[model samples]
Target chain A: MSERLNVSKTYKLYIGGAFPRSESGRSYTVNDAKGGFLANASRASRKDVRDAVVAARKAQPGWAARTPYNRGQILYRVAEMLQGRCGQFTDELRATGLSKSAATTEVEAAIDRWVWYAGWADKLAQVTGTANPVSGPFFNFSTPEPTGVVGIVAPDSPLLGLVSVLAPAIVTGNTTVLVASETAPLPAITLGEVLATSDLPGGVINILTGRRSELAPWLASHMDVNGLDLTGASGDLAVECEKAAAENLKRVLRPVEADQPTDWTAHPGITRMTTFLETKTVWHPVGV
Target chain B: MGDAVSVSTETLTGAAELRRFLHGLPGVDQVGAEERAARLATRSIKTSAKAYAIDLAISMVDLTTLEGADTPGKVRALCAKAAHPDPADASVPKVAAICVYSDLVAEAVRALEGTGVGVASVATAFPSGRAPLEAKLADTRRAVADGASEIDMVIDRGAFLSGDFQKVFEEIAAIKAECGEVHLKVILETGELVTYDNVRRASWLAMLAGADFIKTSTGKVSPAATLPVTLVMLEAVRDFRARTGRQVGVKPAGGIRTTKDAIKYLVLVNETAGPDWLSPEWFRLGASSVLNDLLMQRRKLTTGVYAGPDYFTLD
Candidate 1:
């Protein structure tokens, strides 16, 4: 398998290392902020959403089974790759309409946030969890785990919000199917390139670009999905998202109204490990 | 690097000329009506804020945060939440109406059926309000027909700044007619209006044209609502009450997040509108998080423990 080499085209969706077009056979262009066209992104359908879920389910056991130390190392490596490609992301952001200085700062913050999460992959369990001291002999400890497959509606305003939402989900363990902001989806799709190079197991993160009203419901109501984050949607769409998540008791994050600025410090650490955690209670026999 | 940068003598003069030309633009002297000042008084009328309560009619507008999921089930759940207040102290002011987008008005009205909460829809293009008047009117009519008790329309700040107050007034008056017995809240998008004087003038124009409540912003733009602008608006409301004796409400929406901010608004209302305007009828917070924080603080006061963000359900 290692010896054989072949040329490959890269304009395909990467899920579980198997590149495929959207099952819908549909593609749409992601435009720069100046209204110029960039590369085309596959408009994911309900079928692609299912395929991504399958890939994530397959990858979950092994990834979650890895020791925290190894997971942290891998995540750190991702931060390294992200740092190496900072200039590339900066250019994409600038092309997406952010001022040069804004783009640079955003790229740097995105990279730094990743590094922060990288350090967090191992430590989140301790910080966000607890060991209950009950009156029984059973030792019960609560550890945060991935919530399985996550569906994130990325903020319409790109850069900070995009990375802010995505990083928390994947760093813990729940794989994500993000509907990138329609107006600024290019930078998000480009992030997939960095994930691919960084040795992140495929399917841990899948980026889809399309109309929010079109694709979001499919992801929200999917039986396999465990959680939903509706940060970008406003007004009625937000209400629709809340209603959709209630179907399976999926954990929901409400939309942040326009007036409230994103408080970077109050960002949740819970996403890192809600899915994969099983909450086991162990007991030991004692002699008198 | 070899060539030294040089500025021509005429370039400096040209820059100065451009600045003077901009300052001399027509309608620059027009100050917007004091929407914030009027609202501050409304807060006082219900809360016993001091004096000036008789001149202002305080109307509370709510930006409902009940987001629905794609599933109609989720929609129903949100409907239930919207219909029921997240249980807490009933003593805090009762909102005048549950304000929402057109699509959710039906749900909001349905949820609020048995409750005293009337429904208000933020129509007429909303936040941006850049669409055609026909479109805006149609949106307003649809919301009203759909059971909205009030309409919050945004004045075309672009048109207003370009000295088209006639268009702005006509639009408000037209929407007011469509409203019939329903109320009207005209948003001036104060941040874009740019100055205290323009803000005061805009307030006067909206009230004179029949705005029941003059709101601050659409919550779409940054720096949307601020305290200083509110102060100027209160002064205008005081002046307007002195002139017309018609009590108008004020709504400063967008950026307000915490109890401290809410308290500051309450204080401003007491001082500006006096004690009479301080009630749920006159004062409201256009917020999603404020209710939660209020509930959390209320819980602490009652139970002596702080609740987690996830501790309470929307309903």
Candidate 2:
């Protein structure tokens, strides 16, 4: 007889620190690059997105209240978890059809990028805010704050692109409801497992794996989602999401023109961070 | 067996009459009651029936806001919501009543003055019936004087569970007398009462003492008004009417937050208690946030698409 069968894992959605099946009890097949079957990922429904938003909204206040230094530590812990799971990451990426070297390089950069963002958590406010000279008898200043819950459309590069969008939004204390790469959701769910073990609290980053068309429109029109990132949306779908997002005047980050994704490993700078931060300017009587 | 005296305890007075009647009552099977409630919950009601149930459930709501931090402003806003549940949709019926604490009864009464919706006040130590008889009676009288047309009194779970069934009966009778023309809704606080048997017994105990309606919980306690508990109480009221010609209402307060949950309660009432108990006169849901969900669902039924919370009133 063959050796004991491995306990297979069922890919589930990550919402508010728990791995739950899609409320609709739906799943779609995910195949490796060679079209070999891998596993099924939950085909998240709009109700799942609504639940994620509720959870993100619930966790955001406490997360935003944590000291920026503490948030930095949590993000760094995520990088640490990613590094420990480095072998697994490379393996998952390899099965997605990337060459071994490309897979290894992507895993390394993803970890490095997370570490890079971990440092930005505490520094973002000082880098983005300014003291203003005004004509009134008051001290005036402007500072960027977390803009509450953001809905992210993850780029198709799987591990690197998923990390590229998720790390920045959460580092700033804004909770996120993110859709993982549709075709390449394995690495994304694997990342979700890493996130569960990391010190980062649940709902700070919720990952739902489902169709971009079916899920993105709900996120776009969702009045609760304060911002939308359309990095992963392509062609007419991008245009449709932008149109829907206008209902609430959501702060939208559309893809670079002509259906191109940004270079994932390139210096992402504060663009990702600034995209989700709301600027609050304060003025108080100087002498009072 | 002398005063347990058949099922006609509605007219039965005295401690012996009430206790013998309560003890002689059949014991509730927890598994059976819960299973029946769960089974009824699985009934698939849709389209026109769903729309009707949503609207009917809205009409049966006692829009309640009972809190330590409740203020006149909150009570007034609740009253406004009770009168016009949807400011945008006039087709939506007004709630049956605006429920508040005794202190806010006057505010609720004044805000709902000409709206035709009654004011129901939770009195007699409310969530806990721990106050002395004088204070409890004063609480009831004050709410009634402040213009509360319905007095929701707690049945002293501590007294009821202590086997002092007679004391519990007299307290309700005393409160009922104080209620006068005002409807008296006795809250069993069944969560603390512990068992289905106790809930069934307490239901009969309150009815024997002239409770106009028997409510499940005070909306403060955990396990407040579960579907099974409400089903048991609905059955009690249904049986009570069959034994005596008089009718009493049943209110499953707290934790019923969705239109689906409310409709399930309606189904239980319709099938078990019969269609006679379908109207607001015979049934009610004591809830606060339930109105908003009902309105959202009502809008979903009106418009083909789902309604967002932003489109509704914050009250």
Candidate 3:
């Protein structure tokens, strides 16, 4: 019992702005990057996903209603807090087997990505699109807006990829249910801790850590899910996942080829936003 | 007259006068209240949010390498897939543009043309401006020539820090000249600047150097786009507008995720830049997923039903 207590690590789920152990009370050991047993993460249940959706739905409107500038500013604040934790993120990365410079770069990239998006919250509409020219007495213009609830598969490649997918989705306004990488899930879960402290509205981003292959298909086909990102799946699974996305046409970002080295400069903000955007053309009387 | 004693007293008085003159010099007064007031003025543009019509223009720079993507096609395909087919989504944001590395600018330009989408390229050795001046200029020129409508360039932080403000100013001014009709977004890369005072100084320097927009980061370093840094930059844009009567834009890129994050930026813009700068011309979001959730919520508000993922098609 003493040995168990000494080695046992407790992992909690972030839902509705609070950290709670899974209601199912199921626990699974997650190894560190070094193959050493690091912690026991909650095996989030289907009910937990539902609860998260409810919380996300509840928080959606006000969060969306906020001006983009304010959202940008808050995100900027999160970066400040995260910046203070550079040593922590770096230490975690090192534990994950990354070299010192690699860990530093990973942490820096994550923080930089946040700042990049922080500036975009209030400005995407003008640069990516414009008002439509309708041949009617009504005024019509299109503004790309947020999709309500998103189900994300945090990239299994660890820190950088995990944030790469997660940040783009939520930064633009959609709430997310993230299935973190099974093997390298610590950083993703740590992100949840960061979000919890950063004044983010609850349900905006809900993280679940377990077997990716187990939870992904359920999330992929789940009626509540609005988008899917498959950055970490195996080749065979990625194909099947695409077909699954067709179930509801969930916005699916297929995994990159294994042989290719990641370019680090793809337009993440645009690709992810388009997945959940719906074009709503408003019409109003012009002579009012 | 007591010649010797009076003469000594007179000399002392002259010396005191000389000390006061030296204290009144520009460098000496750099930290004075009047100087601080001027700096504050440069940082903030006072205004009422209601009067300002703030437009939210969001953009996405999908760093696939960070996501672990190796090829440009995969990156471009993803970007093409990311654009909304419908030009207008009442609920979601109409992504203002798609920003990519210059190497992929042509792809983004080709994918987005006639789709009502603009292509923005990160030039001047984006994410890092460690290149030579010639290389930076050539890079900017190439990106613009490749059909990039907006040029996001990073100012030389090293030179700026070394008090070579002239060098920093000259590089941006030169790049701005090369942009022709294209807009120039001068990135301060504020994380590397170290202090709000430096951030403020950099902001002023960029605007003075013909920057159409002053941005905060390269999205390449830690400690990117911070609220305090942004606040200081916003203050600079506001002051510049007042001093020059030429409105300069602010872009606080990097690490922003979620709707709450987007809104905070909006609030900052409204509070600092006033109502006029609220349009897309003045305000924009360099983001990836912000549009999707906006679309979903808008659907819910209008239809009174939660539209699942299938309601919208991916680009």
lDDT of each: 0.67, 0.89, 0.68
Off by over 4 Å in 2: A3-6, B1-7, B43-49, B258-260, B299-315
Question: Which candidate has the top score in DockQ?
Answer: 2
**Sorted by DockQ, highest first, which candidate order results?**
2, 3, 1
DockQ values of all predictions: 0.02, 0.24, 0.11
Which pairs in model 2 have colliding backbones?
A: B4-B20
Give the DockQ-based CAPRI class for model 2: acceptable
Per-residue lDDT of A1-288 in model 1, one digit per residue for the tens?
Answer: 578776632355656655577888888877676767677777777667666766766776676777777777877887788788888888878887788898898888877777777777788778767777778665667666676777888886576677778877777777778888877776676677778887788887887776788777777766567788877676777787778777667777764453355555355455434533445444543342
B1-315 in candidate 3: lDDT tens per residue? Answer: 123212221232342332332222222122342344334434422223311211243432222222224357765654554465233553333456667777777877777777666677788876768899899989988999999889889888888777667677778879999999999999898888876667777887787678898888877787777666776777778877765678888877776654445556666666667767666677666654544544544454454334454455442
Query: Could you give the candidate ranking by lDDT, starting with the highest?
Result: 2, 3, 1
User: Which 10 residues in a row give candidate 2 chain A its minimum summed lDDT?
Assistant: A254-263
TM-score of each: 0.47, 0.94, 0.46
Tell me the TM-score for chain B of model 1.
0.76
* i-RMSD of all predictions: 13.9, 3.0, 5.6
Tens digit of per-residue lDDT, candidate 3, span A1-288: 455545544668888888887777887887676679777788877657656776776777777888878878878877887888889889878877889999999899888887787777787767655676788888877777777777776666677777677767777778888888777777777777788888787888888877767667666656567677777666666676667767666777664563344545455546665666655667777899
lDDT at residue B202 of model 3 (Cα atoms): 81
> Given candidate 2, what's the lDDT at residue B80?
86
